[model samples]
Target: MSRVAPQGVLKSRRFRDYLFMTVGILITAWGLDAFLIPNKLVAGGVSGLSTVLYYTLQDKGLTVPVGVMMLAMNLVLLVVAVSFKGWRYGAKTIYGMVALSVAVDGLAPFTPHLASHDPLLAVLYGGVVTGIGMGLVFKARGNTGGTDIVAQLLADRSNFGVGQMMLAADASVTLVAALKFGPDLALYGAVAVVIMGRVIDLVQEGLSVEKVAYIISEHSDRIADAILHELGRGATGLSSRGMYSGEAREMIFTVVSRRELDALKALVHAVDPGAFMIISDIHEALGEGFKENGV
Candidate 1:
């Protein structure tokens, strides 16, 4: 029974991942066909390349669907991805890219142009929608398998980071867009890229503005008590020895929301004016008072 339960759980998790990938791909397709493609906003990746080719070929009297071009390009990239990263890496990516390609083309005819006359609106909405979709796909441990695969391969062979590599690859596409589509549209594409990146991060990590604070003070107990009572937050005391002072001290570590930061600071100062505090941003906080067991 125990073994069966574990297998069931594993199957459930996998199903969830595939479901996320499917929905993510569909949302991404809608965003591209409705907003980005109609407005000619080439925000990078295989989609951007497809947009450029679609228009260029259109000018040459060839009308190829953007989704078809994307799928073709992704197929070539997927071969490279599998050659280097192995078949295990290709599974989810294959599904993600193929589904996305089909979805984009399938919905293109029915999807309305959301921002046909407003370039700024197109960038904003398209970026948010696509970013959200991509983020969900990533969270499900799936890859879209275009420039992402290229960027990963480049990063493995070079000292540059994956982000830097992705930037370079995507930037090249934008540069091509600049030459083919003109500077104004290319600039909007850049803005869409920035917005998409930001939204993706928010989707993956959440928009929780949690701050981690390390407080060092003589009155650690007092400050901790205040945090527990006044702020309704928990704090831990860590034994530390100051390198410069050669004195053993207790440091207070606490996590609080951004809204409580000022109050925390004030409470700490009121307890010990000479206390040292180091505050940093935390993407997410789970367990206990924060998110309650990563829910």
Candidate 2:
């Protein structure tokens, strides 16, 4: 009975992951067909390469489907994913790639095209929509096998990092786009890529601005107490040795939202005017007082 319950919960979570991945793929496909494809905004991915190839073939009187090209490209990349990350990661990537490719093509016929055909609007809106979809897929711990595999492989083989490798790949794609589609449209595509990157970060991290403050004060107990009572936040005191002074010290540490920063500072000041404080940004703070676990 106990084993059965755990198995059921595991299955439920897996089902939810698949559901979110599917929906996110569909949304991404819609954004591509409706806005990006129509305007030739190749935002540098396997999808971007597929877009460029789709048009190039069209000009050559070949009516190859963009999704087919993407699927073919992604299938080749899947080998790298499997080899590097193993079957667990490869399985999700395979599913994501196939689903996204099929969705992009399947939805194209019924998907309404952007009537205005404005390049700028297409880039802006398409980037946001596509980014949101990608973010959802990422949140579900899924990814479409594309340049990601290549980037990972390159990072492992070389000293350059994954981010740098990904950037290089995207830049190469953008350069190809410029040569094929003209400088103006390529520039728009590049802008779309940048916008998409920002939107993805926004979706993943959210807008919450949590600040972490470290206070070095002689009156550590008073400052810690003030932080707890006035700020309504927990504070920790760490014992440290001041290397420069060869003296023992207590450092106060606390995390609070941006809104409470001024109040925290005021409290710290009142407790110890001579206190040295270092404030920094926290990308995320998950736990008791902040966001709940698994949220």
lDDT winner: 1
Model 1: colliding residue pairs: none
lDDT on C-alpha atoms for all candidate structures: 0.92, 0.89
What is candidate 2's lDDT per residue for 272-291, written digit by digit as tens? 88999999988899998998
In candidate 1, what are the lDDT values of residues 1-295, reduced to their tens digit?
4365878878888999999888888889999998999899999999999999999999999999998999999999878877887776657888888899999989998998887889999999999999999888887888788888889899999999999999999999999999999999999999999999998888888886999999999999999999999999999999999999899999999999999999999999999999999999999898888787621
Find the candidate with the highest TM-score and give its number: 1
The positional error of residue 264 in candidate 1, measured at the CA in angstroms, is 2.5
* Residue runs of model 2 more than 4 Å from their true location after superposition: 1-4, 80-88, 115-117
Worst 10 residues of 1 by lDDT: 1-10
